[model samples]
Target: MLLANVPITVINRTYSSEHKLISFADTNTLLEICDKFQRPFLHFWTTEQPTLILGINDRHLPNLAAGLKGLAVNHYDYFLRNSGGLAVISDPKVLNVSLFIPTATHNYSIDQAYQIVADLIQTIFPSLTIAVHEIANSYCPGKFDLSVNGQKIAGIAQRRTQRALVLMLYMSIAGDQDGRSDTVAQFYEQGDAYRQDRWHFPKVDKATMTTLANLVSLDISVEAVEDQITTALAAQENAIDLSSAPELLRSAQFINEQATQLKKIQLRNNQLPIV
Candidate 1:
């Protein structure tokens, strides 16, 4: 309900921004960037190459070959993302946005983060028929899925490091939800059937999920979503471009150390690594 209270002042910050999404064959570089940049930024890009992203602690494989590679699904690779949440489909269409908000600016609980997203979407389509409620039985179900008529349109996850909290979520702009759910369901099945461990996969439903393009009766492209994010973020602060930062470059060794230590200690209570 507070979605509209996201001060227009923040939205009016630097009307022009240079936020661009870069593709990845592996998530290591992205993770490195996220850990290194202690500021707010956004991007929307995807890989032409397929990589089956495993949860940080999703080791139903237990060091065994898992995902498409193990099943010989052809051309698909398997690697872990340095974050929370289970598998979902990612490509150019699944527009990904990361907002690294300083805790000092606003203390964010999970709900507050979702509210920020809800507010942004509301800004884009102020009159669109939609609801920001939890979608039950959806893949990676969280409190922040923007839905329409009980079908999910997004899944959100937050990654916090020290005082900076990064909320990473996907707006499935155009894709086969049923197809993506099938891939996740099969991955869970394979990981469970092949490895001798009890692990939980996101309960994805082919019918309960969809994309923004599908949610609205309009034809939406990933490029459109990218523009919307640039707009929303520009409203927040005088965003600096992602130019080559020597200081950021110099901090890599230390950043990697922090990341490694975080991952090593994150695997508690039988949970997978966060990446």
Candidate 2:
């Protein structure tokens, strides 16, 4: 594995119980910073708020008014994230993990990157029989969707630039997977009326999604799995803290700058008229 040859120097960040938009922006910034510096990073965060995140390629709902009203009814704030996927639901029980690596540094092909991420996940939960394949009825269906016992639990998405690539995945740790799926399904029912003829959103089946708690015999709390992630990372390569590494000080500075830039971009985006 290419990951085995490289030292796991990560800039760790946690956004537990934080706004989804803020965390999304921060993750976006981290990807840029890591790419700019040609460094590898591991980022983990969790969102407590129920939010519906739309993919950039997703159809912009023609009737956003009804979509916004539907979201308000379900107590889900909505936003579009800069990533490759359709609508996905997130709550406190879901844990989002992202890996930012320089494609040139690692000589990574797109397939290789997906394999590395799937391998890392298998490393985290070694006891379980995890299968990586597409779930046709699942929301955000993809070839890299991780499943166990014929149930989809996590979906992987990637964004590749000239120098950097990000493998972002979300795991259903412990939550009402059915309810979350239903929420997204209904949101589409109301929002599907509006279309940009861009991408086809899935007609999600609530039964297609499952959580880790349901799949594994042992406790699979977000914190427990998070600890497992760090442990697994340490076993694979030396994991360092950003503050402790003086030689990589510039990466930290770049992250700060990216945060500021993202805030301004988000603000400008929000100000744009929805047509």
Candidate 3:
């Protein structure tokens, strides 16, 4: 995990200092803040409840029927994000962040953006215990997964809109990875297994998935992890703002629109029981 260092260039800013440690109760609120910022923001967020988000182009997910039924989950609340990745595991204990960056080039790629954020994360965990490698056989497998040596601790995704790039992330601070993994594994196992083609589904290694609490050994601790983020940000030349309700309301509206469109598709295909 990389820490913030003052860049010598005047055209750039190590803007991580301007980030607000926002505690969002809903994913929609997280989405809205990204849309409302100027100097770009990296929001460390969380959800009110356990939720599953699918990529808009993820049409090959399997076992969706059994996945929804097995959860006793209400699909009305599920949203299909207009971004990349299949499904991500997110919960209250998890620390999720979205970075809204403005790229001048029209051909900005997700890999380029993920590299910038992942590098910062690697700096904080210099032990290199948190491996910055793609955890294959894992849900939403990507190049930017923050793994502990061989195990996965965090995952990152990219969402862009109107030239604004929002880098979405899900960090398992302290929760049941086995439980989260089960949900994802089960979603594919019982939901729509019959629909899977040659494509592989998100894989979760129960043994490998870990939290910050589980990672702290002797010299490094969870408090250290917390301290580092604060200390690292404080050492920088930036300020963080608390998100407001007005931003939340706008987030809810975006969630509604995304979920509504997903509901229609899920109902038509018998993927979700919401309709």
Among these predictions, the greatest lDDT belongs to 2
With a 3 Å backbone cut-off (N, CA, C), the pairs that clash in candidate 2 are: 62-194
lDDT of 1 by residue, 1-275 (tens): 22222221111111111111112211233344444553444534454444455555565554434454443474444444556766656655666565545554456777777677777776776656668767766766767777777887776777665555656667778877777767766766665633453654555667888877766655888777767766665665535444433344346663565465445433432253322
Cα displacement (Å) at residue 74, model 2: 1.3
Q: After superposition, which runs of candidate 1 have C-alpha atoms over 4 Å from their true positions?
A: 1-38, 61-66, 70-75, 193-198, 235-275
Model 3, 221-271: lDDT tens digits are: 333454455444444553433344335335666457546644544453344
Clashes of 1: 11
lDDT values, one for every candidate: 0.55, 0.72, 0.55
TM-score of each: 0.68, 0.85, 0.67
Angstrom error at residue 79, model 1: 1.6
Per-residue error for 25 in candidate 2, Å, reads 2.2
- The count of backbone overlaps in candidate 2 is 1
Alpha-carbon shift of residue 203 in model 1 (angstroms): 3.6
Q: Pick the candidate with the highest TM-score.
A: 2
Q: What TM-score, to 2 decimals, does candidate 2 have?
A: 0.85
Ranking by lDDT: 2, 1, 3
